[model samples]
Target: MTDLNQAIETLSHHEEGVFPRKALETLLDNQEAVNPQLLDYLESVAIDPTGTIESWQTDFLVVALFLLAQFRDVRAYQPLIKLLNKLDSETDWILGEEGLSRILASVCDGDVTPLQALAENPEIAEYIRSEAFYALLTLVCRGQWDKSALHDYCRRMLEGGLNYEGGYLRISLTHICEMMMFSDLLETIRNCYQKWPEMSEFIRFDEVEESLQSGEADEFGLSFHRDYITDAIADLEKHACFVAGDGAEGDDLDGFDLSELFGSPDDVASEVEGFFANAETQETFVRDLPKVGRNDPCPCGSGKKFKKCCGK
Candidate 1:
């Protein structure tokens, strides 16, 4: 066998971690000696019909491809694209999902055609939704595409929120919005909040608040916060309406005893007054407490430290 063929055989037979690491290092060091052999191996791995490639192998291949792409090796493009398509075809393989995401990100450096193809594939749409959403988000953020497309896509996805089979997708949409800094997407989330009020409480308003405070605002800016908060309040109002309709059946008043529920007016007033009095006392005690930091003196007045004391 030729020297290059021997190197390829040695790489294939070695364990994944060490072999890929060494082979990649060698390829980077001696490109002329190993480039053809490396390309051939990638093609074989990309077309492996048995689906026997392990997660480590997939990770190595993806990393190798990413490195090649970074070098602007035009020869790597077709093979990487083929691997991406193959990964998209194998939805049952979780490793493929990760590999495809990495590959898409790597190739997205220049040509977006592969991503567009993946986005347009119906069979892989659901499986590839998050990656596609993110890629489009990157495009919008980088001014590569018109914002209208992203807005329309987000709107369509949110419109189907009620029927979504995966909660992760819903959460991912929120993440994508945050990443893209697209405040317009807030309206879509608002529609979702209107449909499901309980979900309103779970929304991370603090992140939005922080984003706004940091001046990292993107398209639509602070309007995102205003719309989101307004929608949450509307959902809360709807919740109140439902409670009113449920009347005595509502759990809002269900946890009390008979006496608490329908007691003498004076007795109820006294109990309420006592409850508030104790609650106020507890609140005062808490409010009067000294703040402790890791470097601060202990509340016990110990000279050692807070973290070293009761704070521990």
Candidate 2:
């Protein structure tokens, strides 16, 4: 327990016990020393995630990411982005939706360009890319970025054109508009629906219109703003991801049954995992995003080639 590697090992190698709070405490006390090691560990994992996936029984990676983010360590940003870029869906099974949100939001390094890339890159997984959209909100909420700039950026992204394959990105942007209360973007959002009619699976035009009609953003809090160690510890204190010494696993679904967090492996276009605050509203976002084949007639039925119509 004298070093971070040992602490990481302790957290990683445990079997049938409570979360190893002691090891985490040791690393937190030695944050300055552990940060270098933490960055290395993150970079190594980001470079080659095989080790993490192969030895996936423990909560160690969770500990590593939470620790790095707790300190807002800029060194970890690129590695974290790389990890997500190179990440397979199996790895996301471990991070879960909320976990992904926390990590992406804090690791932005005050420059959202990387996050913008992640959000815009259709090659990356949808859930991962979608989280980046919300991470912008987190930055704005924390007062680190200008909401107006974000609004303009989002408008440009909207104007850039959204194809069928990346329809979910438009929906994610729609969610952002609601959060920021961008009434001016209402027409832009409507245009998105016009282009990608399938967006109704997650949100209806009237719903967005009604939400905007209220003219207020809902209270939102996704990232921690208090003491890092205390909040990070609080996050896992009764969590079910790890087996603690006391053997008190919390009531939430265990990590083993986490397929719902991403989607059924058989389905490529995954369903939604709730990251929203209201239960009813969260349900509105949950659906297995339907895919539109390239050659098939466009759903919008503009009487043109599918590609010429609402194309990806």
Predicted structure with the largest TM-score when compared to the true one: 2
User: Candidate 2 — which residues are off by over 4 angstroms?
Assistant: 1-6, 14-17, 55-58, 161-167, 220-230, 238-240, 243-312
Model 1, range 20-133, lDDT digits (tens) per residue? 344444445666666565566567766772453653344334334444533445566566556546654344242232223333443455456666565545555344644555
Give the least accurate 10-residue stretch of model 2, judged by summed lDDT.
221-230
Candidate 2's displacement at residue 136, Å, is 1.5
For candidate 2, list the clashing residue pairs, or say none: 17-243, 17-244, 18-243, 18-244, 18-245, 19-244
Give the TM-score (vs. native) of candidate 2.
0.68
Cα TM-score of candidate 1? 0.48
The digit string of per-residue lDDT tens for model 2 on 1-312 reads 346668778877755456778888888989888888778777777877767777664256677788888888877888889888875445565553334555667767568989888877666666677667677767787777798988997898888743326466677777777777888999988988897887775557888899888987633322222112236676655343553433244656556676566745545433233332345564455656445555332334222123434563
Please, what is the TM-score per model?
0.48, 0.68
All models, RMSD in angstroms? 19.5, 13.7
Candidate 1 residue pairs that clash? none
Candidate 1, overall lDDT? 0.48
